[model samples]
Target: MELKKKLFPFFSTVGILIVVLGLYAFKSDSATTERYVAQTRWENLKVLPQNISKDSLDYLMKNYALSLGVKCTHCHVPSKTDPTKLDFASDEKIEKEIARGMVKMTNDLNALYFQPHFPEPKPKQVHVVNCVMCHRGAVNPEKYLSQMGEMYKTYDPNRDNRKEMFLEQQKKQ
Candidate 1:
């Protein structure tokens, strides 16, 4: 019995050490795996930038706009070609209005829900949303089609004859 007791404690300590070491190894391996995945995605993005359809862009823009609680006109000027044009494209009027509205919304939400419950003197920092949040990687067609169906409605296959072109390209491949 005495021998068993001594051996039991030693075995328990060794088992715990093994588990800790295994977990450490697993965490290190996961980091390496994530790095490889990121590298692959970067390569794919470089090669496939042209394959990104307009529907995909619209979907990304819509989600990004929603996140910021603003409309598309905020970033893209209606019927304007050059985004840098200060008159309509980069109008300070629209930017200021959107910024003020966002600030007000964030303040209101924080004051109502976060500030009262928490003893923190300062209110929570307002999160300014952006495009890269959801569309971090290559465009997901299924998500794009579902989210921004309206943008794709006017996409006439006859205009570009992309269906025929795709078939010809596929046969060549």
Candidate 2:
């Protein structure tokens, strides 16, 4: 009976030591993994600015869209393989038309309004818009749903009624 009791305490002590060793190993491994990941992320961010070229931008945009769980079709017309599609919708058939229209609008604004007031050069580059400009830090599903819901309510399709409703809502804020 005494031998069994002594063995029990010895086994218990060994088991506790094993558990403590396991926990220490696990914690060490996790810290090492986190540091490795942080280093990799830091390297990626360092290279990102240097790697930003026309070809790289195209690749990055596609990858960025994928990372956001969307495709170029979300912001651009799928039917038009070209970047400069008239309609930004998925089924747009016209090119140059929408692009030209946007160019003209921007030009008119710059020539008549902006140049006279601001003394800035007319924007020479075509502005490629993306999701991040609006979404910013919002990465979760619930946040997206809530933001989209609010946007829809503010810009509701029932123009005649909702215009006043939106204005009233805006005024309240």
Candidate 3:
């Protein structure tokens, strides 16, 4: 019984040490990978963190991709010199510019709506809207009023007579 008691304490201490070491190794390995887009050297970042670590940047990008059901190439364009590598700094892709605008819009909406205005009592959450709220893992969300599709028809905004004349000529033939 005395031998078992002594061994038990030693084993417990070793187990705790092992767990701490394992966690430390995991955290360091996850954060220290070489990043093409460095946290400090970022440019053209409008909505996302201007100074974000590589791991954090990757984490956020993954969430955004999952939210929209898209790959990174949906917003970021590949380098012309090397198609495999992404041109992170370039805004040659119009979608990237549009994404910045979308981020701003969503943040603004959250600021206005999601924030609680309780003076006396504090609320639980600062629950803000994310892209996933609307997207639900889709590039384009399915229309709620799909049945009313036929009701809305395109009207020609032909203020000039040229478009009308062109259609009229086509009818005669």
Alpha-carbon TM-score of each model against the true structure: 0.23, 0.23, 0.56
Quote the lDDT for 92 in model 2.
29
Give lDDT tens digits, candidate 3, residues 1-173: 99999899999999999999989877855444654443466777777777777787898789889988899998888888999999888876666766676678777776677655644465543447888887788865545334445665763333235434655777799
Which pairs of residues have clashing backbones in candidate 1?
none
Which candidate tops lDDT? 3
Cα-based lDDT for every prediction = 0.51, 0.49, 0.72
Clashes of each: 0, 0, 0
lDDT of 2 by residue, 31-66 (tens): 667655321222222213544555665676565565
The TM-score obtained by model 3 is 0.56
Query: In candidate 2, how many Å is residue 128 off?
Result: 8.6
Count clashing pairs, candidate 2. Answer: 0
After superposition of all CA atoms, the RMSD between model 2 and the true structure is 16.7
State, as a TM-score between 0 and 1, how close model 1 is to the true structure.
0.23
